[model samples]
Target chain A: MDTIIQTVTSITWQQIVMMVIGGVLMYLGIKKNYEPTLLVPMGLGAILVNFPMTGVLTQTINGQKTEGVLDVLFNAGITTELFPLLIFIGIGAMIDFGPLLSNPFMLLFGAAAQFGIFFVVIVALLFGFNINEAASIGIIGAADGPTSIFVSNQLAPNLLGPIAIAAYSYMALVPIIQPMAIKLVTTKKERRIRMEYQAESVSKQTRILFPIIITIIAGLVAPVSLPLVGFLMFGNLLRECGVLDRLSNTAQNELVNIVSILLGLTISVKLTAGSFLKVQTLMIIAFGLVAFIMDSIGGVLFAKFLNLFRKTKINPMIGAAGISAFPMSSRVIQQMAQAEDKQNFVLMYAVGANVSGQIGSVIAGGLLLGFFS
Target chain B: MSAALTQGFELMLFGMGGVFAVLFLIYLVCIALNRIFSGKPKE
Candidate 1:
């Protein structure tokens, strides 16, 4: 009873703050539908870790250090970089590269949109973070949570919790963040620009070959990203091959769902108040928002630049889809297009650009790894 | 600019440039692959 009393009283204001944060995350996830699968577990885990004397975290028992459940999971999963890579496989399997295959030019928009990652690196540096931390913070612009986790885990492990939070929170907010950024750079006439959509007629042979060739190219270009790029493309191969439909289904469903639960909760181990309650965390979150906005601006401006040479005009709104929140960013672009003109349909192009953003994001992450790590 | 910020500018230059260069290569390769498989629009 005395020990329990001590434990209750030992809780600090910072712990209360973290618990409040955890509650807010849970509320945002449950009520607001903000990436609930990931955020819910993360929120619960944050609450679990913040209590003064929890067995979920590493503790000294009988003067001997005993690893807690979260620590063991973190070591085996996040430290070894297993969880993010596994999630990547699921992401790859779920992505239908059909639209991207129909319009390979969308790949350019995807690459162009990664401008935020680099741009934000400088901004983070100006804010007094070191190069590695800046890079980790900047990867929030990738808008690919797994890649953000993967990059930050290696580059700035200490900043992992904030980076992960910022990455995911901003990703869930893409619909709100992107439009304001897009509208800033694009005129209403540019928003209503339309392009013809071709039916996806990519052959099964091309489908099978696409993943394999892209992996090989990634290997040649950025061998360091081979593990990340290779696993993702392997999952795509499993999907496209049509021979391993069962495996692909398992990857997309059970494997992904289970891994997401573990990944979300495991990262929260870093969210203990001691590490997380800091001035820098708020700055990181702000930087992530800036990164996201810049990504939208970059893609939109690139489209406007390309429009200089084209006979047929391309919708600049589709360029904002290149920031890689997947179908969500693309959907926002489509909705905005409809808002501008009811008859205009840019869903196909937006989807193609959004899908390309996935590949471009990984490639951009690979490039950063090449530069920094 | 501080040395770190200077390095960052270089990063923006090369990083953005690297993404474009590699993706452009991928674009060329993808076009090549499409021609071999689909055969309609001239590359």
Candidate 2:
């Protein structure tokens, strides 16, 4: 009876709060359809781990050590950095580099938009985080959840939960966040600016060679980024190779779905109340918004700056699509353009910049690893 | 500025510079490939 009472009373307010947060995440995922696949597993994991004396985590049983499934999964998948790399293969397979290949100049927006990662690192430092912690926190601006997890895992493992949540949450909120950021910086004229997209047909050889050359170039330039870029390009190679359709289909579907589940649940281990309920956690969340806003601003301003020299003006809003949130950011830009003026279609250009953002964020992650590690 | 602040600025410069440099190289490669392989304008 005493043992039962102790077990029942061991539940702290913090644990209850975490469980509620987890429930809210699940609710948001299921009802709102916001990253349901990731949020549902993460929410369930959070609730499971927070239950008093839960057996879901590794513990001593019968005076002997026994491994919990989540712990085993976390160790084998996340700590080894296998899950994110695997997810990259799926993401790489899904991406069609055609838009980007047609408009190669869009790559600059990808590079420019990453300014937030570095900018927020500086802000985080001022807020009293050490260089490594600051860098990890700033990576939330990468707008790529896997890259955020990969970088934070490498640099500041303790802050992984908040940073990962921030990255993904902000990614989902791109529609709300980016439009607000874009609206604040750009005038109505800039928002309504239309650029003609001439579909440049790329050769089959170029399609196949693009991934190979990019992987080689990125590896040579930033050797440390090899794992991040290599796996991504390898996946792209499988996709563009045209000989591995079955393998590509598996990578895009089964492999990604399985790894995403493991990745979400394993990441939830970092969400224990003891680690999550901190002033630093709040700061990470706040700084993540800062990073995202800065990324949008960086891209927009760079585009505006370029427009000064070019006779044929580029739409400044396309720059905001350069963050790595993919179709969401691109879609937001398209909606905003239509809102401003009907019959203005810039989705192709936005997508070009958007896909380049995928490559940009990965390289930025690699560069951060090289500089800090 | 404090030592941490100084280091932060240095990292910002290096990080942004490195990203731009890498992406610029990729851009150049794409351009070279397009010029070399592409036949003529389709439309």
Candidate 3:
């Protein structure tokens, strides 16, 4: 009772603000449906850690140190960089690289869309962050939640909570954000550009070899990317290997769900009022928005540039789908296409681009790790 | 003229180049794999 009274009386304005922020995140997660699995737990954690001398973080009672679950989880899971990598395994199992393997041309858009990751490196640098910090923050443009967590955990751990929030929040908002950026740079006729997509027959050998070959290529180019690329492709190998359906099913369903839940809650360990209320946090959020928007613009503009030389004009919106926001970016592009003309069934092409983004984001993350670490 | 700016540009040039280089290689290899392996037997 004494501790409770002391905690209530001693609570600072920052703590109060953090609780409010936590409440807002909860509202968004529950009502607005924005990355609910992550946001809900993260919001609750924000509220959990903010009370003075909160029990969720390590505390000394009578000069005896007591371990907090959140802190323990943070050290075991995040500090070791285990959670996000584990999440990648699940993501890999869930993804079908068939869309990507069918059309090699779409892979270029994957590389092209990564313009935002490097672009934000400059933007963050201009904002006075150090190289490693800038690099970690720049990864928000990967638009991949796990990649963002993985890179930032390695480079700018102190900034993990805000970066994670920004990555996931913006990803959930892809439906809203991407269309705005797509429409700004594309013409109605460009949006209406139609292309034929025939389901190509991919050999089982190609399917099995695809993950293995890409893993080798990633390893050769950026050896630091091995853990990330290796783990992701390992999951894909499990799916494609034909003998591991049971394990693949486990990875896609149970493994992903459990890890994502823990990963979501674990990231909030960094969201304590003292760390999360800084001026720099606001800057990270802003820069993240820039990264997201620039990524879409980069992809859209790339397709437009290609149209200049190609005899068969490509829908510039297809380029925007190159963002690793996955089905959301793909969905946004297709929706815009259908809105312009209902007969425009760009969904299959968008799926191809979307899956390409899955690979693109991991490579970009690996490259950032190689450069900085 | 800042060190951060220099580093940023260096990253931009090489990073974009590296992404394109690696993915472009994958593209060529993917094309080859289709021709070499398509219509083959399953395991």
The TM-scores of chain A alone, one per candidate, are 0.98, 0.97, 0.97
lDDT of 3 by residue, A1-373 (tens): 9988988898999989999999999999999999998899889889888876756888786688888889999999988889988988988898888878887788888888888899999999998899888988889999999899999998989999999999999999989888988889988888999988877878899999988998898888888888888899999999999999999999999998898888888888888889999999999999998888888899889999998999988898888788788778888888889999999998878888888888888888988888876
Ranking by lDDT: 2, 1, 3
Better of 2 and 3 by lDDT: 2
C-alpha lDDT (0 to 100) for residue A72 of candidate 3:
95
Docking class of 3: medium
- Each prediction's RMSD to truth: 2.0, 1.5, 2.0
TM-score of each: 0.97, 0.97, 0.97
Error of 2 at A300 (Å): 0.3
What fraction of the true interface does each of the listed models get right, in terms of native contacts kept?
0.60, 0.76, 0.66
By descending TM-score, how would the candidates be arranged?
1, 2, 3
Cand 1, B chain, TM: 0.79
User: Candidate 2 on A1-373: residue-level lDDT in tens?
Assistant: 9868976798799988998989988997899887887888889888887865656778675577767778888889889999999999998898899899889999999999998999999989988899999999999999999999999999999999999888988898888899999988999998998888787788888889999999999879998888888888888888999999998898899999999999999999888899999999999999999999999999999999999999999899999899999889999999999999998999999999999999999999998999876
What proportion of true contacts does candidate 1 retain?
0.60
**Residue A86 CA error for candidate 2 (Å)?**
0.4
List each candidate's DockQ score. 0.50, 0.73, 0.53
**Global lDDT for candidate 3?**
0.88
DockQ-sorted candidate list, best first = 2, 3, 1
lDDT of 1 by residue, B1-43 (tens): 4999988888888789888887888788778877789835423
The true-versus-predicted C-alpha distance at residue A207 of model 1, in Å, is: 0.7
